[model samples]
Target: MHRPACSSYLHQLRRRLLLLVLLSAISAAQGHADEFIYNSFSGADLSMDNQASVIDGLLRLSEGTDTKGHAFHTFPLDFSNNPIISSNTSSVPSFSTTFVFAIISDYDDLSTDGLAFVLSSTNKLFSSSAAQYLGLLNSETMGNESNHLLAIELDTIKNQEFGDIDSNHIGIDMNSLISNASKGAGYYTPDGEFKNLKLNSGEPMQVWVDYDSERTILNVTMAPLPSTKPNRPLLSIPYDLSSVLPNTRAYVGFSAAAGGIPTMHCILGWSFMNGEAAALNYSDLPLKSIQQLRAGRHTYKTIIIVCAVLLPTLGIAMIVSATIVKVRMMNRLSKSRTTDIEWEREYGPPSFTYKDLLAATSGFNDKMLLGRGGFGSVFRGVLHHSKQTVAIKRVSPESKQGMKEFMAEILILGHLRHRNLVQLIGYCRHKQQLLLVYDYMPNGSLDSYLHTQDHSTTNICWAQRFCIIKGIASGLFYLHEDWEQVVIHRDIKTSNVLLDGEMNARLGDFGLARSHDHGADAHTTRVAGTWGYIAPELARLGKATKATDVFAFGVLTMEVACGRRPIWVDGANGEPVALSDWVLAAWRGGSITDAVDTRLDDYVEEDIELVLKLGLLCSHPSPNARPCMRRVMQYLRSDAPLPADLQPDNLLRIGVSQELRMMSVERPMSCPATTITDLSKGR
Candidate 1:
């Protein structure tokens, strides 16, 4: 009987052990089902579209100009059935994803387009377009709510239509090409300072995206490869995934496109899971893929080997060549040193060597030319010492009076420091050549976007235009009242206003700027400014003051709001009509809001009316009647209400009628006797 009992106990023990092992196996299987990892794409199960291919264990999304590519997982994943939470809730389950990527371009400081990490309801993006659309949507499908798509874009081009902040930035999108929220591509340091990152640097970087269902918050964090992830996220947006997607099942992948310039977008590794994603090992990633795309590493090694073999054989020849070259360089250096010393004695700004500027601008090649202005032509260059990109303005060599304007720019911009003011890096003088260096603005002048005839390029939206207006006002306020000396920007127009990499308005072209001590009258003897931007009193007085700058700003305000030049030829009868006069007529006709840009799809009517009315107020003919920059800021920021007496009839009584009559008769008004014949010629 005892033996029979022992046998039964042994059988029960064996059954219990088997059950435990089976449960552990199921748990492991579920974990494996919930996550996916790709250390290499050589033999990975993926669905690829045009231009997307896996070669040598690297995933290349786009490799040439005017190309679009898509790569998605072969199987869809259900996000609703998260192991950490129940599936009964309406909110989508939380998830995390991490990836490593690199963008390689042929040029160092320029790139055409970028890439995106996408999550879509459908596996294929058949209706996508290339270029600024990022291979995610087309004109017809963009902004469609029924698309059920979400994307995190790493953009390298500033597309005004979509309201991109700058060329290099990261943005979050939901069912539309326009990002709902965006930030410049950068990461925060441990001390909380921001450091900008160049997306097309051809160096591997890691990105982490985590969504918390409980808080409905999505955090995006990025850092260079081999470094631990930063604690602070680059962007944290509050949104619900359910609102962007019809269901919890979706395909995850990457999409990229190139525009007119050659660029290659690549992905090295990726991992995704319902919970935290598995950490990526930098050692295991294909970091050399970017270098290979640029020029094969083996090719570099071969060059190094050939140099090693030839160095000893050519030693005597190289010694003689070096001595001869050194003597010539010494002579050139002596002349440059003499010229620099003379400039330093006369000017307060720092100076750059002519040789350095030449190398920076590639000997001022035509391809590096940015634009020609009334005073000079600007070139994009990168300094060798700091690798900092700059804009070098080469003044016209034929102008005998160019020295005066060049000195004015140096004296004024050398000491001024403001976010809205263009920063003067230094100056270079070589014989008749006069070059002024400034921080490079990648987006170029504001007029290009506002007045371009190409309808193919999207117009800047109302929001961006309004922001630019406010920014210019703030800069003017600083110049007039906040600085040590009162500054009068003799020329304040759209062409003089440049946009930086982040699309912020920066007042440039200080060649015509003038400054005076507090409470001192401007002693300028010649009037200088664009046609319609010049104040009526300036032509008579031949003097520029803070009020004259205000007048120009007013015209600029109207130009930006109307999306027309300050002086444009009427399409109907070929008569030049001033922007301010046209806007004033609209106000008198009780259709002031109609003066807003028609290209704008949406706008706040109240804001539009306020801007129009304020512009007219500032453009008042009498200098004493025009509001100062301080008051103008108040009006723009809503800190103070506009004067109630500021009606069209009241304005007409205060010389608005005379001003309109003069503008109509003169068409493009003439400036007081000055050097520039047609102020708009070079622009």
Candidate 2:
């Protein structure tokens, strides 16, 4: 930690060395370095601009210096290859003034080399300062740096200052790191004010430096490439940036010091601009820059004009075009999509275009598959121009899930977004060729882990299982108790719970769900959901409510803990037994531990019991008697007490006990893409 702090201090110390470059960037933004091109390898032509000196004789490629001493002896600096204009006025805009350089180097040896962007009061090069080595210090075989330059070196080799943490990178320098280059080892304005520079990187790093000589303000924009927009230059820095050069009329250049070996890199090309001091400090200007900018005043004016005139006209045209295209696309969609869908009651039959889905799922290639559902297959494809990957539910023409059910789902799910609920990225309505695009979940559903043979279930240690439980609970709690329109996940099963890379669970596929509010009655619907997980009360009154989901979740939780299918034909000992009935009978007999999975022996005995109790709560036969998923989570995570146990005598005594079978697909459910009709009453 202490060494880390020292490095931080060193970072702070070294940054001040670039105060000259920072200040020059600022000054140049006001048109400072415009006079000399960075390629002036010689010291004669520059007017103390960025230490930019013009050298008539640099080590060209053919006339290279392989010697140990006087190392700037030879390199390919075709005056044409690397040109910077010296003794010239810079017409570069105040906000736009900057130096650009292209550099290429073929190394002779790891000669301890680097290139520097220097901003100094003296334009003279090959002079004596820091040992008078012309940016190359010492009479050694490797490298050298100059004392007379305030430089920003993009060094390639390790030095005595820092280590290899930053391999082949950029740095700031002032004189010799001795007294003359960086006074006080910090930055300070001539008037005693303080400024600092911050550095970070992105790809294809583009650095924008701004210097407002009026305020002696220096700022830098350091970012790698690929950002959507350029970032702001961080100012009000972490270190003082004004103490590099004692004089204002200094030159800018590069410096490298090598004692043993030689390292080579070069400035292949260069650009320069002269800058004048701005009246206001660059830091103080909120109007963007000294250059005349209309962004501030014209922002709303331009938008308002577009909205008032162009927007309405475009909107009408767009609407007309959309109507015509919608009919055609819908017709095309009907051709490919099967009519075996249960359209939503309110929205009528789904009208997704087949061509749109074709485009979205890349023609339903195996690669685009999302997952297979009880009804049909889900595929991932992009919308035409949006290029967005949507989960396209292609209802099989011969599937059991009906059309109205799909519509019912769409009416409810289309308007949701939650942290634990997968985002409904977009949807399509092509006659029967229904399709939907959601924010893709590359990580498969929870079933992938819990039921996989690829060493998945065993790896889901207690921590991961706990997280999945909590995530599913949060999502269900949102659907059940949080939303204004209370959503009831009629079918809450492990397969519908999607998992992200982090194993965060997203409760999805609300095909058998229902929604209501405080003022509304729970809806009456046929018993729905997976065979082993549907609430018992659902088969009787056909009423679906929030408790229904809680029951399903409870079943899922138990399956997770038990590490077995929800139902089994015979007990391990060869007796007829349902997992739920077996667990209940044992609970009644004070032998609930019999229901816990043997594999969970490492889990705390009490934790297993807690999970068993939750499962019982879900398997409760009466909808009115079940606790909400919210309470389930509270009991799971918090110290909340469980509700009193319900006696088995009265549970589901009157429902379809005489004869009820699962797979009662009453309402025609459409594909997960077009409609959510699966939750409604059966025929």
The best candidate by TM-score is 1
Cα displacement (angstroms), candidate 1, residue 339, comes to 7.4
Q: What would the per-residue lDDT of candidate 1 be over residues 300-408, giving only the tens digit for each residue?
A: 4456455545543455455565776665665565556555545654573245779999999999999999977556788999989657799999999886546778899
Q: Over the stretch 189-246, how does candidate 2's per-residue lDDT look in tens digits? A: 4454443321211012223445443344555433322122133442222222335443
Off by over 4 Å in 1: 1-342, 455-457, 571-573, 653-683
Global Cα lDDT for candidate 1: 0.81
